[model samples]
Target: MISKDEVKHIAALARIGLDEKEIEKFSTDLSSILDWIEQLKEADIENVEPISHITGMENITREDKAEDFENKDGIKKMFPEEKDGYDKVKSVL
Candidate 1:
C-alpha cells in the first residue's frame, strides 16, 4: 500500500503541485499499480527467453540514389527572402 506522504514526496520530486484530493487520488492509483506489480512477481517464466523485441523487424532496403527536381527556378522563387543564392532571415539576437 502506498501512503499519502509517499505520494506527496513523489509529487514534490516531480515538481508537480497536487491538492489534498489529488494526493489522495494518486495514492489510491499508485497503490493499485503496486498491487498489480506484486501480482506480476508470481508469474511463471522458466522457459521464457529474454528478447529485445517481441516481433521480428527487418531493415527496409532502398536504392542509394539522388535525383534533381525539374522546377528549380520555380522552387527558388517561392522563398519570401533570399540573399546571395540562399535563403535569408532577420538577425535573431
Candidate 2:
C-alpha cells in the first residue's frame, strides 16, 4: 500500500496540485501499479532474448544537413512585426 505522504511527494515532484480525494485515488492507483510490477517480477524468463523494440522497423530518419533557405525575404514579409530589419518576437522568458 502507498502512503498519502508518498503520493504528496510524487505530486510535488510532478508539479501537480492534487486535492485530498485525488491524492487518495492516486495512492490506490500507484499501489496497484506497483503490485502489478511485483507480479511481473515472478515471471519465468530463462531463455527470453532482450530486444530494444517489438516492432522490427528499421530507422527511416534522413541524414541531418543544413539546407540554404531560398525564401529569405518571404519570411520577413510574412512576419507581422519587425525591428531594425530583424524579426521581432514577444519575450518568451
Candidate 3:
C-alpha cells in the first residue's frame, strides 16, 4: 500500500492541498490503482495486433481548391451584416 509520506509527496508535486483524511484516502486509492496495474502486467497480448485506435473509421478529405469567387454581391445579400466586403458573424472568442 502507498504510504502517507508518498501521498504527501505526490500531492506536493501536483500542487494540490490535501488534509490528513484526504491524504489517507488517496493513499489507499493510489495503492489500489497500482495493484490493478500490476495485475494487468500478466495479461496475454502476445499475438494481439498493435493499433493507434480501435475504431475502424477512415478519414474523409477533399483536395483544397482555391478559386476566385465571382458571387460577392450574392453572398453579401444573404448575410445579416457585412463588414470590409465580408460577412460579419458573432465573435467566437
Best by TM-score: 2
Q: What is the C-alpha lDDT of each candidate?
A: 0.89, 0.91, 0.91
Candidate 2's residue-wise lDDT over 27-62, tens digit each?
Answer: 999999998889877889899987898797888798
> How does each model score on TM-score?
0.46, 0.51, 0.46
User: Model 3, range 46-68, lDDT digits (tens) per residue?
Assistant: 99887887786679688899888
Local error of candidate 1 at residue 13 (angstroms): 1.3
- Which wins on TM-score, candidate 1 or candidate 2? 2
TM-score-based ranking, best first? 2, 1, 3
Q: Which residues of candidate 1, in runs, are more than 4 Å off?
A: 44-93
Q: What clash count does candidate 2 reach? A: 0
Q: lDDT, candidate 2, residue 74?
A: 90
Model 3 TM-score, all chains together: 0.46
* Model 1 poorest 10 in a row by lDDT: 50-59
* TM-score attained by model 1: 0.46
Clashing pairs in 1: none
lDDT of 2: 0.91
Off by over 4 Å in 3: 44-93
